[model samples]
Target: MRRELKPLQLADCAPLGTEVTDTDPRMIYHGEMIPVMTPDVAQGIKDARRTLRTNRFRPTGKRMSMIIDGCAGKTTLLLQIGRAYQGLLETERRPDSVWTPVVHINVPPRRESNMDWSLPFADFFGMDHTINIEKRNYRSTDMTEPVVHHMKESGTSLILIDGVDRIHDSELTTAFDYFDCLQDRLRLSIIYCGRGATDIVSEGLHHRRRGERLRTSQQFRSSLPVMEIKPIPFREGAVEEWRSVLKAYDENLVLYHHEPGSLLDFETLLHERTGGYMDTLDQLICQTAQQAIEDGTETITEEGLNDMVVGRQDAEDDWA
Candidate 1:
């Protein structure tokens, strides 16, 4: 009864109350959400924003390109940047003088291939790709052309497109055309994210010779100043420091009563399992909390953390 508060109570008790339940995994997991910040992740955002300000943050300028490799926390950082930009645009509202951020798009790919070269922006902006069977006089061009007109009228700064790896090679070539066009057309910042396309980039556009493709695109790699997000720095006795993180959530959630070995097992388990991705670490902590609840225990146990690693049924997508 005490844990289940009224709907209004949740709002009224803001900053004052927290719901505690024996079975709710959120009790510990929500409170103890950890952020793994490295120089790469932290500095990239600073540098990206600096680049945006310097590049005039408009699509008319040279399209800013950032190629982040796998597991470098690219997606997470991009979303953070989007939110930060949203806040800035919301504040700097000079309807005619300034442009504002509007939408964020994450497109993987469609089932059928070979979309029109221009459909990258239009298809995402709600143009019907399916052909008209009943002589419906439906034209995709008409649908897309208005969006360009709308952008010219409205104050839209950018349309962020994330996860470009899913686009097929043919589709990607078509996308390049759209990017080239959008740069000339509107104030749209098209940000694309993918892991395995650096080679394609090296081969297609800029390489001087056939074998020199990889070496030539070293310019792209070397050009960006090597921003890599790394794991949280841990000292020799870092397990003790990790325990303090748990204690911050709830004193009862700690292991070994504030001793050195308090969180050694968890630290080792997570470091081995996920290499310290913040999302994986948060999931691990939540899974442990659920185990503790089911076991009717107060302290997070070594077995509980291990169970989280082992019980990842969706091994490919989950922490694995």
Candidate 2:
């Protein structure tokens, strides 16, 4: 039997964040993420896990890259994949055992040196650099060694590097080299999330080695598969899909119909306005809901949408 949807209270409209809590149905249901997993994203996750499992037998693995524009929910998707993998580990574990199946790190912006790239990895593993280095006189690489060991011990196979576009051009080689080191030593599959395919492709081309530099240059291009996350198109039944998402939050909510002289459907109009971007669509829905609340109505009217659009323009103008 299908369960009836519940209406959302004001508190249920909180701004969405990257992290998702399994226990909060409101957060999970009404979040920016619409629970519509794209085939490419799903296959990417599967490939990462497969590579990890394959490494257990033969130790040869490959890496994946996701090139998505800003505000396209790349971080949200990565977090979801990481959390889902962690959940899987929890199900197959003893109560006292620890499992760390995924390690997600946001590459620091404008990193100019090798150590800068390595520090995040060391920090993620909670390695005490002061004690390991000052007292034990350990090298910088020594701090990162434990990460590899822990990953191997904890059954961790996927390392997600976010903000790959943030690495400066001058330090691109250094960053890629560091990733190569990790791949070779830990036998882990990696997923690098960047802003655009052009940046990644150009960098990969620029670093290609013809002679001595050729070895390191081809490292990224030779094995890594790059995938781009495109916007969800508004096609047949798209309105129904979006309506279902809205209903999850507010069962009483209704989409306002066009009054007259409207050439497009609401879903098509939304897609055209927002370029079918998930984050923009989310913001529009939230803002429309807020407007509905202010007007003491459960429906989002055309007037409310126009106000929201104008308000967005005003905000942009202010920034400008």
Candidate 3:
């Protein structure tokens, strides 16, 4: 027998916040993923997964980069991949043994030194004790080797380095040199996530010292293949598709869709406002959902979206 429909509660919907929850398996397995996948992003995932699988035994000593604009969902995709890979590793784990297939670390913001870059790895792999010992006995530049050794021991085949763009312009050469050393020593497949290629390549060109120029130039055109993320376009059926996804999540979820001024109208407005960026779209959905719950209407309307815009503007004004 078919059950009676009820308004979907906000608590039932996926949680939304500033933190990147894309890697959370609960959300992903429950079909809360962003419904759009560009060809570039799709191909990049395929290539990266293939490299990881291939190098798991053969040791490719190759690396790849996924370049996307800020808030273009690079971290989301990387986290998703990491979660999936870690799940696979869990199945193969021996009794009382740990296997970590993917190690993800974010490059520290506003710092561009090898020490800063290597510290996250030590922390991620829980090698802080070893790192501290090395710090007391050896120079800061020597800390990375122990981390690399720990990674190898842990059966980590794929390393995802997020926020590579955070590396300062002055430290670009050092950053690339460190990456090169990791590739040479570890023989593992790596994926570097950054905002855009221009910033990454330009940093090398603009700031490299005279002696480092030739070497840095050679590394600038990375041997690793590059994947560039393109913005998801606002299309004719975008709203309908998004609505269908929402329905999949909760059939009783009410949304505004009048004939002349339909949901597509609001979608079109949003697309124009956000330039089809996924992050902004996510924010809109979250804001609308929260507003719907608070109003006890269980319905999303153009007015609600307008309110979100005004609210955001007011917040910014307050800050200003």
lDDT by candidate, in order shown: 0.50, 0.55, 0.57
In order of appearance, the predictions have TM-scores of 0.64, 0.64, 0.66
Off by over 4 Å in 1: 1-39, 57-60, 94-102, 111-143, 200-227, 230-265, 310-320
Q: What is the Å distance of residue 269 in model 3 from its true position?
A: 2.6
Ranked candidates (TM-score, high to low): 3, 2, 1
Question: In model 2, what is the error at residue 180, expressed in angstroms?
Answer: 1.0
Ranking by lDDT: 3, 2, 1
Which one wins on lDDT? 3
Compared with the true structure, what per-residue lDDT tens digits does model 2 show for residues 230-268? 666556755554444333323333223312222223555
Q: Write the per-residue lDDT of candidate 3 for residues 1-320, one digit (tens) a residue.
A: 01122334435544433232544332232223233444445666676667666666663435443343344777766665566556655678752344566778888664466776687877787664333464576334435878887877777766777887776657788776776677667776667777764457444435554233344434554335566655556577555544433333333233322133244546565655556565666666566655554554445677787667622233344575
Candidate 2 RMSD computed on C-alpha atoms after optimal superposition onto the true structure:
8.4
Q: Which segments of model 3 are wrong by more than 4 Å?
A: 1-40, 57-71, 88-97, 110-113, 129-142, 198-222, 235-265, 310-320
Question: By lDDT, is 2 or 3 better?
Answer: 3
**What's the number of clashes in each of the models?**
0, 2, 0
- Candidate 1 is scored at a TM of 0.64
Two-way lDDT contest, 1 vs 2, winner:
2
